[model samples]
Target: MTIWMRCFTGLQEVQKEQSDKLQDMKQFLAFIKKEFVHVIRDRRTLLILFGMPIMQILIFGFALSNEIKNSKIIIVDKADDVASRELISKIDASKYFEVSNERISESEIEPAFQKGKLKIVMVIPAQFNLDLHHSGVSQIQLIADASDPNTANLLVNYVSAIVKDYQSEISVPGIIPYRILPETRMLYNPQLKSAHNFVPGVMALVLMLVCVMMTAITIVREKETGTMEVLLVSPLRPWLVMVAKAVPYLVLSWVNVTTILILSVTVLNLPFNGSLLLLFAESTLFIITCLTLGIFISIMTNSQQVAMLISLMGMLLPTLLFSGFMFPLENMPEVLQWISNIIPARWYYVIVKDIMIKGLGFASLYKETLALVVITLFFFIISIKTFKQRLA
Candidate 1:
């Protein structure tokens, strides 16, 4: 009787262990199925994971070719001699520069440079041919609008290369006389550090992206989750609610701006030669402008997904391309250049460069600052109207 009882208990114990193992296996399979469903159902997640990499590659890959072509230029040809004319002809022939105007007076250089009409303004010496004949080497000045310093450098290089080639062809190998000596004077970026060129661009990009994306996304999130209706029913006006939403991000943006400036100065050696107060003020206007734009986008779109796509495509791509972050505005085609003028970052970039590199104050920056204010007002008004419509 004792052996029978013991055998029955052992059999029951074995059955219980097998049952437990089977249950564990079933739970594991169910969890894996849930994970798979999540990965497949959330299309945005999948797109972000895969599409971003592909898009980044496509956008930046072709832009990697640094060849500057069809740059606008004007010549200050004081010498109409055969040598100077021939040199100008060679410069025009090169695919790099398309010469549109020629000035006889040297005083015209400042106005042309200030107007930013052309990239390179070559000033051929008055005695270009005579000097070459007398001293074997004649000097030519290439004043570049170095606001866009990278483009300026490329232009200088192309012109220098052409001059060197011309010299090699004209001069005897050992004698080395009758040479065109190119002297390049960069206006804005004297040191030619790419950091100086790109840091302002980075600031514009960061300010725009953070403020816009955060404001738009946060508002859309509340709408998506149905919390917006609760807020809408309260004492808060739609515009005020949007403002409230943006205020936190606005404060956070200043914090981020400070961090970026600090890092730029300490780590990247970015020059803050301009007033800190003015910089912060300009940055605030830009942030508010972006925030207004974001709220406007949120009002237009019902879902978080659409808002995100619109902001990414609308702000990010244009800011990167038209804002002269990677490619110089002058280097872009005429149509693109015209289009870039409307991009807020384009204006802000000039402001940033003027501040950080040129070390000019509100005196120089007033127009750009005014432009930002107008943009902010325009977007704010539009968003307010949109909110009113939504309430109606």
Candidate 2:
């Protein structure tokens, strides 16, 4: 207790007094304006600041996922009989396989398989049904592409399940009744690949944190270093200077997004399954919302370190936790789930994932997209009011 008191007393004695109120206030604004101009000049920081969100989105969309689906198959039926026809019908009925090719000649099989046109090929011998009826056995060969284990396994299951169903229905009762089950198509990730499901959400969270932290720290740094005072005395309005500070970062962020997207598709082999334009549009709005959040953090913290800490701890935590990054919103407690409603990253994740992974159009994303826009507007209005109040 004595040691604690001594430390506290020494810290209080060493603390520097604040500058004169009116003069310092004016100088702070000038510094912010000058720092804003320097921010405009440094293009790389600008790019990372602005383009970070898009890069994160692409990284998350393409790099990570939990489900895989939609394998391709080929049918080569020599029998072309009723029983063989019944078997083919069953295979076609399954949603997991796309009938990408059909082959009759033995030579065509090598060519089609070599070209990667088929993941599996089903062959029904000419006398398959005749032999089954008489000998109680039929020969059907399933040639699977062994290169991709996941697709091959799923393809085998689908083909086997379909044929078993047909055999059971025609077989004597109490033996093994087989019936065609209802097709269970995956609504979002039809292919069921893990990358498509996770990348979108990952992208949202990464971009939000990077963009917000970069903007908030940069702004606060100006105030800490005494540059904000020079800019306030210049002719520019506070809002104009703020916008000027923010715009370059926004443009650079978009560029970074493009680079990340190229890497996602070319390097990571992830699919771009939605409108690029809509993706960019929503991304721009989301970036703006994040920048506003940074501005708010800057308003509260005089030190760049504090601004960075605030952005990371305050913004990143809520964005990751409430935005459904680690936990499913549906599975969360009602209170936490409801709280997620206000999280910008959560809304952006839904928008990006729904549009990019699900291939959903504007109509499908309207509600979520609108919520993001509304949130951005709310932040902008609040920050503007707060900034004005600080000046007054």
Candidate 1, 15: how far from true, in Å? 80
**1-392: candidate 2 lDDT, tens digit per residue:** 99999999877765532334555567556645665577768788767655665555555554543333456677788897889888776766676666654555655776777887578888888987898887878888888887988667767877887787787776766544564547678775566565654566656665676568877877777788887777677765677667656665576557656765666667556778889998998888888888888888887788988888888888888887888856779989899888999999898888878777667788888888888889888888888888889878
RMSD of each: 16.4, 14.6
TM-score of 2: 0.60
Per residue, candidate 1 scores C-alpha lDDT tens digits across 1-392 of 99999999999999999998897666555534543454457677546434433333333333433557788888888888989999989989998889866554788777877876677888887889998878887999998988988789989988988998887777766675454655778776564556676667767777777678767887888899998899788654565567667766676567666766776677656678888888888888888889988998999998888998999999988998998867888888899999987688888888878887788999988888888788788878888887888878
Lowest lDDT 10-mer window, candidate 2? Answer: 61-70
Q: Please give each candidate's TM-score.
A: 0.57, 0.60
Compared with the true structure, model 1 gives a TM-score of: 0.57
- The per-residue C-alpha lDDT of model 1 at residue 7 equals 100
Model 2 global lDDT (CA atoms, 0 to 1): 0.74
